[model samples]
Target: MDKIEEQLRLQVYLARCGVGSRRKCEEYISEGRVSVNGKSVLTPGTKVSDGDEVCYNGRPVHPEKEHVYIALHKPSGFICSNQDRDGRPLAIDLLSDATHRRLFNVGRLDYMTSGLLFFTNDGDFSKLMTHPSSHVEKEYVVTTKKEIPGELMEQFKKGISVQGEFFRLKNYTFKGTRTVHIVLEEGKNKELRKVFLSRNITLKSIHRIRVGNIKLTGLASGRFRKLTPREVEQLKNQALENKKNNRGKPKR
Candidate 1:
């Protein structure tokens, strides 16, 4: 049987209870607005287990379970974050007419790049996809400023190390003058751009085509859909398999 762990910091528990995110939860705790088992706790790192009593903002907290998973065809200029302080276009706004569930993106794609994005109330799933250890495959079609050299394409396939970030191009093929189909697993910020930039290629446009086994084929930009049950199951199984695969490997 697989061992399940429900361990997290106290502030994280509070944040999951809808009080706020971990950072915001710290503020509430420090201001004496949070309590556990009737007594206020100011520490953020206090370990919490399942069934622990927590109260925030004068209300008894309950674990949120009405999870929602949504896949959106993100358009350029839409930030992949829940809230942007700069008032820029955001992906969350794309789901404004959605069920009103407090959903967060499973992973992120930069504002300049557009394509498939996942959002969910399932924090576990979100963490799995967003976590570097998961190594879920993400595919993007990128346009470059100039023609890419055959040698650089070879380097892309062999993999390139950026600063300290190691990334391998799972698949790469020229689409046209300066466009290439690239598949990657590392979803770090602007990693794609940095990769091509290292090869002396300047990125002009980028659009994601898939995440893991889920694709944005029929889905048009700015549209959203609920992931089918099979897709969800496939993602979960893939995550578990990936976790098992990376048990003792060096951090990549």
Candidate 2:
């Protein structure tokens, strides 16, 4: 029996080669900035094989030398973006030596929030971890200005409607009158803030402590370490299981 040929869409191939995210690569394809086998390919769906030569903006795009998965203890002042127009510090800047490798944040942490932020060269892994349908849980320890009322706590546990949408905490524990440890599977932007705002609660601090099973333990703020193979596999499995469970559900 002959082995089947392996091929991937142009954009996906570019992402795998660390050129950019799949969406950015699609834009490059649409703009006629990508070429395969010396011919420009304007279609994002164009397929390419391992033997095909691929280039972007007249530069060769080689496959990533090795996939790097990193967990960073993001500080409060840095933005989780590839580039910042205002010259503010970016999360990627912390990985100085790996900048050339096209690492992307697995998800985002707001500039004011600090905690476990993941970086990876593998675009697929990033997508799996960040995609809404994946339903990966995020755990946070939040500090507020005042204690949460019993009524509001019950409302939070049940679910609350905000901006025509409903949001709920998967689980929460009150560490004290002003501190709460919360877990959320559907990580909408500023989700906790929205929940608190509805109840007239003032948020003082929000720090993510865990994603999936990975935790922000020994790593100091602004520091990072590569993830072990087992850790990476565990995350991938979680994403896969969540995706399977969420089949046919509307994606946010």
Quote the lDDT for 204 in model 2.
91
Worst 10 residues of 2 by lDDT: 1-10
Residue 121, candidate 1: C-alpha displacement in angstroms: 0.6
Candidate 1 stretches greater than 4 Å from native: 1-8, 11-44, 49-61, 250-252
Q: Which candidate is the best by lDDT?
A: 2
Residue pair clashes in candidate 1? none
Q: Give the Cα lDDT of each candidate.
A: 0.78, 0.85
For every model in order, what is the number of clashing pairs?
0, 0
Question: lDDT score of model 2?
Answer: 0.85
Q: What tens digits encode model 1's per-residue C-alpha lDDT throughout 86-152?
A: 9999988989888766666766788899999987766566667766677788889988889977677
